[model samples]
Target: MNCYTLIKQKILAVITQLQSNGGLPADLKVDAITVEPPKSRDHGEMSTNVAMVLAKAVGQPPRVLAELFLTHIQEFDEVRTADIAGAGFINMRLHPSFWYAHLSTILKEKEAYGSSDIGQGHAMNVEYVSVNPTGPMHAGHGRVAIVGDAMAALMEKGGYDVTREYYINDGGAQAETLARSAYLRYLEALGQDIGEIPSGLYPGDYLKAVGESIAKNYGDAFKDQTEEEYLPFFETYAIDAMMDLIRDDLDLIGIQHDVFTSETAIVNEGAVEDVMDMLEEKGLIYTGVLDVPKGIEVDDWAAEPQLLFRSTQFGDDVDRVLKRTNGEWTYFAKDIAYHFDKFERGFDYQINVWGADHAGYIKRMLAAVKALSDDTVTLDIKTCQMVNLMQGGEPLKMSKRSGTFVTLRDVVEAVGKDVIRFVMLMRRNDAMLDFDFDKVKEQSKDNPVFYVQYAHARVYSVLRQAEAQIGQIDEVQLQNADFTCLNSDDEIGLIQVLASWPRCIEGAVIHREPHRIGGYLYELAGAFHALWNQGKEDTTLRFIVDDTKVTLARLALLKAVATIIASGLNLFGVEPLKEMR
Candidate 1:
């Protein structure tokens, strides 16, 4: 169903025939051959660099090779003409029937039309929104959640067995801080006049309910207990409460993880020691002093030797310390063990969606995965940059109710889940995004989400109008319509875009860039809107024409547009609206 792929295969077949006839060298490499849309529509429908790529190897000039390839390619019935363009590029124009038949495929296949099988069912673990279990998720975490979930969906569409995961950061100082924060709330619930929530403790009002729940469950039982005894109990309770809060926040935005891995559980299961021992056996672990990182001014820097991992051998900039001088395992030690556990779970690929602040950690994490899987498994880390929330072009400060940052729930409540998810993915994950309250909710072309959804709504409206004006046109009638009547330039251009859906999905999955889907959806929407506008200018271009045959064909095309839009929106976890209101 991918026209570009189909054309490439045809070109390769011609090259193979030429090789057998000694028209080209047998050993010429063809892997670099690519067939894509011509840079300018004036050139041709599609263009390829196959001639230039194979010319040197086949002992011929690029122009000579281009002419030879063009002669053979033009012989195919699907191709109307093939011409040599700049630098010996082969540009091709396919017959109109080819595009019309592809449009028919789209109507029949509907939402499943653009699916791909490139992943071959490989297990891929996409870990995202691994924010600490200390508080509710923030705006940045919302971006990560949307990116990861969309990526998982994209990979799933591309035939990968995807597991959406969240790694809870509950084994560090952050969790302890959360526990202390909850304890203060617990004291407040008991009517204690604890003033101004000590500087380091969480001061969000959301924890007040957790405190009340704790009091109701255990009734002054731990009021007299020492910090050592009560801290553990409170830490466990607070973490559970915070996780519940986080899940609720994510639920508002249609995000739910298949797996929620706990760092403490990994440590408790001796995973850290197991991985350290394995690395030690490979001579990657050692006791050594490390130089301070450049530009870091540590007031209490230590010079003593410590347990370290030889990560430099695996392409990391420096050997990392597994355990500090105080003998506690470092965060990196637990992270390494976590990835080893992921490998042992039988995933062939692992993807981590991290905040932009964690860019420096990518190399070390990749090194850990490489060492653990012996470079057999692939790990791709996508770092999501900051999201600046704005109201009328002015940046908004942290929520006073949330204490530190604007909660994900705050944004989702302001703009519904659909807007939040769609707008978050409108940019590349590594690029900074501005989420404007006034802009995203606007019902104009300026808002990508609204524009795309309006396209779907417009399609539905056309179908309704067509049914009321002309008699009802069901699936069978639409399928049997004479698509050859769709000879307008706008119609043909739209078919070309729709025919590229499978190729777009494949490229997006291979690049691990879900933003590409958003971009493609916007482009498809624009083409659809353009065609709709064309119908307004020319009476002959109207979808619901006097001719029943032409009307059915145009209806089929509009349905195909809606089908693809719904398909792409589903991957983004956003609903395609049937009506704009």
Candidate 2:
């Protein structure tokens, strides 16, 4: 069992013993008492605040309660010592065997070492990179793609049935613009001299390639037809081409979505009207006018009434428009229809991963979900802040409309996928990340991706050297090896880290944050590196030593640490290096 589980059980037993001894009530709930590693290593292996939480209710001083609980907790095989620290914190030190026994569990579980059932098969749908289909994906899109993919992996490891989804915005005025742009490309592909692209239209070379493909397919047959005849064909062709390019880009970064729900499909299949009828029946949507948005002024803002959704009832800043005065449906209406479709499809929870610029849109979108489903469905929108790219301490500029954007493919090509995935997860999703191209690509220890990978590689190196020295060291033999030989401070620190993996996973999964995994891996690497450096100072500290049982015991500890590194790297979608050059 992991250290956290072991400590929790001991704490419960102590509580029961206290109640039985007439020091507390028989039915006191001990679920809130928790055991965690102390803030500093000097305190103890684990600490609990059970006394502080139960002090007032039990009618005793916290320190008195802690001393009373300590007498009973000291009998457990896991805890070697239990002492009351300042203000009622009880610090507990586990016997060396407590950590030594975990080696067998790690070797047996292997890849499943850190997996947890915290989610208990909860269903979650994560939608990300729902970028407009008008242009190629820029650098910011790359950060969101990496962050979303890693988050899904982490959630799945926590036992959630996660669905990765992409909402394709292939409708509205943007669609018309794409069609017009493609039609212009079609004319140019036919060898006609078309002038420079107009100011408001897309001006990328990707469109030129789409134009060439259309020229080869239809030739000059549609040259005489008006836009009314060619617009539909162009729309279908352009959307398909744009999706193809996006798929290629996602593939480069190892991002794969299970569903590609198109907004146009909702309108084509009459789902939009069906959803609106449902809202009308509930009296949630009505005809009204939206006040001008805060902090901005528009000259042509209409004062006319329009169709609006009563989102303010559900905590939105204001009611949102569902239709303009011209009788055309607004983007918000189609988005509401899309979420209604998700709920109808039986998703227990919906997670939308949006860019930081979309923060203002989250409140109303959540309000719409609440109004439509009576709060049965939960919508959680995580907005990732900007990723500022720097190379050798210089900023990298990117502009999608100006055709100066750097595609996701360029990043993965420059730095491998493993580096990109791990670095993106080194900070919380909401925090701005400065991705220094120079630092991430470095081979030094400061690059966390390489540092963690290198620790695993070092363990493999020792294993290979051990094999050459002792022919073979099978796990069955290692299990029976005398673990009492593990005595060095570095060896003990490594054991402590391995025992904390399950707790780390539990915390990261609870907060829906994956950056904790990155921080934990870095600490694990530090432990492994410390042990390796110790080996340099004392040659006898090396993993293999003439088939000695102590040496075998050290190898066992090494294997446990490496197993955790591999498990954590998998959650972050980073490959564990078997050997570093």
Q: Candidate 1, 312: how far from true, in Å?
A: 1.3
lDDT of 1 by residue, 350-383 (tens): 8999999999999998888898888999999999
lDDT of each: 0.91, 0.84
TM-scores of the models, in the order given: 0.98, 0.94
Model 2 error, position 569 (Å): 1.5
Model 2, span 1-581: residue lDDT tens: 55787778867876787689886888776667888999987898899888998888898999998887788778777788888899999898888888877766787788797788887888888889888887677768988888888778888888889999999999988887888888888899998887988877777778887888998988987777898898888888899999988888888778889999999998788887888898899998887767777766677676788788888999998988888767878888899999998988878687888899999999999998998889999788888998888889899766453376776666777888888888888998899998889999787789998889999999989888888887788878767777778876667777888878888888887787889999999999998898888768888877877647877888888888888998988887777888887
Please give the lDDT score for candidate 2: 0.84
Report per-prediction Cα RMSD to one decimal. Answer: 1.3, 2.3
Per-residue error for 44 in candidate 2, Å, reads 0.1
Best by lDDT: 1
Residues forming the 10-long window of minimal summed lDDT in candidate 1: 293-302
Regions of model 1 farther than 4 Å from truth: 297-300
**Model 1, residue 98: what's the lDDT?**
96
